[model samples]
Target: MRLLSREIKLCSVLVFLFLFSLKVLAQPPAHDPSKIMRDGDRYWTFKTELGIGAISASNNDFSDWQSEPSVFGDTWPSWINTYVPDFAGHFWAPACIFLNGKYYLYYSCSTMGSHVSAIGLATSPSLNNPDWTDQGMVVYSDGNNTATVSNAIDPAIFKDDDGKAWMTYGSWFGGISIVELDTLTGKTVGEKTTLVGGNHQDIEASFLLKHDDYYYLFVNRGLCCRGVESTYYIQVGRASSVTGPYDGWRTFLQTNGRYIGPGHIGYNEGRLTYHVYDRDDDGTAKMMNTTLDWSDGWPVAVEVTQDPPGELLPDGTYRIQSFDSTKIVGVANNSPYEGANVEILDFSDDNINGTSWVINNVNLHQYQIAPKNYINLGLDVYNCVGDDDANIGLWSYWGGQCQKWIFVDMGNKNYQIRSALSNKPIQVNGTFESGTNIVQMSNNSNDTTQLFTLVLLELEDTTYNQYPQVVSYSSQQSGNPASNIIDGNNSDGYRWSAENFPQYVVIDYGDTLSISGTKIWTYQNRAYQYTVEFDTDIDFSDPYIVDRRTNTSAGQPITDNFEPVAARYARLTVTGAYDYTGPWVSITEFEIIEEEIVGADELTLNDNTKIYPNPVVDVLNIQLPAELSSGADLAIYNMMGQLVFRKTGLKGNIELMNLSNLKKGIYSLIITNNKTFVTKRFVKY
Candidate 1:
């Protein structure tokens, strides 16, 4: 009878184990919705609680959305210390870009009206599920020098055709500045250059776009974030070169009402245009223009104008036959007049020929009623670049060298305006106050000097039939010829190539071996699978049997440690790879070293004990020491710290009841038994 009872007991235990395994597999996986955005396509939005002031998207539209973290019930990272606890007093003006298959997000932190702000970088593999790796303080503003605010904000990155990287940024402090960047090392290569000055209404938030042959400079003018009194608006100028003397000879201005602000420009498909900025009366929430058009070299707010084709006159000019205008409601057009009238004009001696035009009675300058009646010649206004001592004057004529600017459309509201003379554009210099003088200079093309902003203007009847001209500059190869190898060179397999890595190498071993030393060697113009052989004989055929590494494309030597291996013939094999013309695995000499071996099992945990309720249905009893007092408390935490259970006044044991409501998973328990606190990890089955 005793033997039969034992068999029955073992069977019952087996049955319970089977049921528990089934329950564990039945639960669904957790869902993470934090990275999803409203736009269903190639866009995403993630909430960052670094400072909690404002949240701006990588898309560069800065009108609406309070973007505060506290309002969204988000908290800052726990690692932040008490010194700058409010996270440097709020994060504002963020920028992001994708480089080498990683997403780099840059942000600014500082208080209002202070140049103590700093720019930081965080990296992730994907916009969703972004494991933000914080790269602290790439640049900081100087607190001293009242005349020049050193606040470093608004970072923009541009990669030239030659693979060289540049960053442009700046605001209120000094004007805009640019710095050449070493993308591989995340550092600046040379001294920074002051591109544009803060003079002539150049304020916060600047962007650059390369269109055709010009680098267009876009900047925010007037006041921003001032409730209903915000004078926020955008202005533009261009140059034929990256750095320049960006002439505002063809500057476009807009006016609606108290609703006047900057417009966001972007390129859909291959068309270059702008998005109208729409903000609520409170200036908190903002929207965008619904419709898009590009006939006038400027985008109108949600309205489309269609004109019929006409024949050219004897004077080599075409007349605008007819046009229709419509107002985009809810899209705040501050114009007192509800509708705009269109007309075509023929200027006899003007170089401007074969262009459509629309005349508006709106005043551009505060002094003039209608000086020259704001002409939208349908030609992009390119900023200019000239020498510091060069006469960078703006003229109305189409001839002089200073009047030339290159217009490039850099997809999303970003542009690059280059100068025809110096092949650069006009850039903002120190981050000084508004009305600081703007200057023409070389193309630093870095984010610090690139300016981005919005512009609000009425559509005019002027449309140039001829597109702006652009001059192409040849891309040149750089670096020492002996040190650097081109892509197709078969001399060195490890030479720099554009191929990306599939997976990173990881080290694993069954037993603790002294990893005192290891080294890898490669031959010229060939690839090899170099690895440290240990224990058994090296087998190159079996991928899993041998630990191996491929040559790096950076053309650098690699060596590591693998010690105390009682084996001979430490050889490297030429595995399958590209550019393998000869035996690439070459070893001049191999050395063996004797070292101490440490085992991972030698590690231990002190004063900590974990418990578990193996087939528990409801209550769980935690065994404690007899020295525990009645006032002792026991706190229980789930995997996510939802506080599933808690108790006080424990004697020799703690009884946790009413646990039938709990789910099956891992849990952490903290028991304070008579001043001897113990943290225990357990599982509820």
Candidate 2:
């Protein structure tokens, strides 16, 4: 009898396991999941997992959710499967909203390669105990006589800042589209709007959200299936209005480290959540989340710290600077160690791999600083010529003991540095004195010797575009002065009246400059067409056309990048306006820009001194052919000309200027004995 009871218990357990599996399968599918909507404190959403039908779910705490009936409810009485024959049994995308005590669910009923598709809606009173009632078809595209030009899939809704309702939909068949919608009926109104279309229609799965004054459009690009092989990811563009001619698409979520297929996502409160396939976990698509920070008013994903896997520092290249010595460390090009020498020199502005370090965190507060060029070859820090005061250079990054570094945050964005290679902290060895070679020593005296700060290096054009010798311009109308355009002010844009055709402004860059482009700012969306030209003379003799743009609609200040040319004179010609009133042209601010060529910018000399390895790594060897007084002064200045490192009473023939503590980049090195002094350029790797 006991054996019989045991068998019954095992059978019961097996039955429960089967039921649990079914419940998990019944939840909304991962591909193109619906954006969650809030019903008081409870949340509700829909998904395209069920074919030709949409699935529903609700949760009060967001941790646990219970699946509800199909969004079409009781029975899908429509012949949607007939139109979407290829994908007859499945829905593509779904979106939900809670408005006026009614939960409205919208979904795309479509098939592969068939233009005959439709977006339909359903209404429910209570999302938790949903009894969805069909609201009939909202929009459809048959690709027949005068039917919709869009594919009628991937629906997203946007409620404008002013409380107006709009819907965005469509897929590969045509392009992502938008249309105004009635708030009361949840049905589209007004003329169908073609937001984007044609061969550039390599996008789908649209999602929209309004933050601050901008409306952000998120879309999925590339293929969606194949698990680990899926190339799918999310991209975004933003505009000031719900109906938009969005700008270039930027990767909303970048792939590479851990996740993949970050598509068909949603937003809630401050966090953006999306379903992603884990490349390391055999492509099991799961929900992933991230917070955002504003970059010049645009959203950039910020990684949060989680234990175990790789914990990365903020991504970007940097120049490691020592707080004590204030010099940068580098691989010596002048007095190189046997393979790649170690030395210290004044900081430089140029990004040289041997000097520039690519610091990536292995875990929180721990990182591996690799040379930029070496990183490309998969080389990291290794005790290459292994020994005490070993030859440290780039080598393949495996799980080696010497590669790990611990950055001790010493308040105010500074750090007290230590390494996993040795128990001693990294000190600007006085061998330990001023201008001393940096070496890792046993825990000795505590001073500023081991302190360091990572300095950010500008990657943009470093070549300064001369601010023009004279502000020269012309205009036909009154009230607006021609100087306003070249005044370099945006307080109020330049305006004109009693318009002039072929309105033009001439710019004299003071001296000859290699013209590349110009930054034009104007009254919002007024400049429809404009042209830029460069020449050596104002007559435009040997005129070189820089760039011309027609139908310019973007309100943001326009950036026109062109091939660099040598010219001292550039001209701006306004040809037309989109919404022109009478014959008038208004120019706000026009500025000339120059190409930042690698070798064109020479270091300004404050004096003259000889320093070897123009771009030095470790030691900035200074050898004066002449004798110097026992009491001599030497100093290093950064690009900003700020004094960073200095030494007094230096009496020597050759000074081994220890720069291992300075940030990598260009710097002005100065030396003086008696009344004689010299300043010259030096670089730290």
Task: Report the poorest 10 consecutive residues by lDDT, candidate 2.
Answer: 1-10
Candidate 2 lDDT = 0.55
What's model 2's lDDT at 504? 54
Candidate 1 matches the true fold with a TM-score of: 0.35
TM-score of each: 0.35, 0.43
Listed per candidate, the RMSD to the true structure in angstroms reads: 34.2, 21.0
- Report, for every candidate in turn, its global Cα lDDT versus the true structure: 0.36, 0.55
| Alpha carbon lDDT at 205, candidate 2 | 75
Scored by Cα lDDT, where does model 1 land?
0.36
lDDT of 1 by residue, 456-516 (tens): 2332222121111111100111221111111122334323221111101211121122334
Clashes of 2: 31
**Per-residue lDDT value at 196 in model 2:** 56
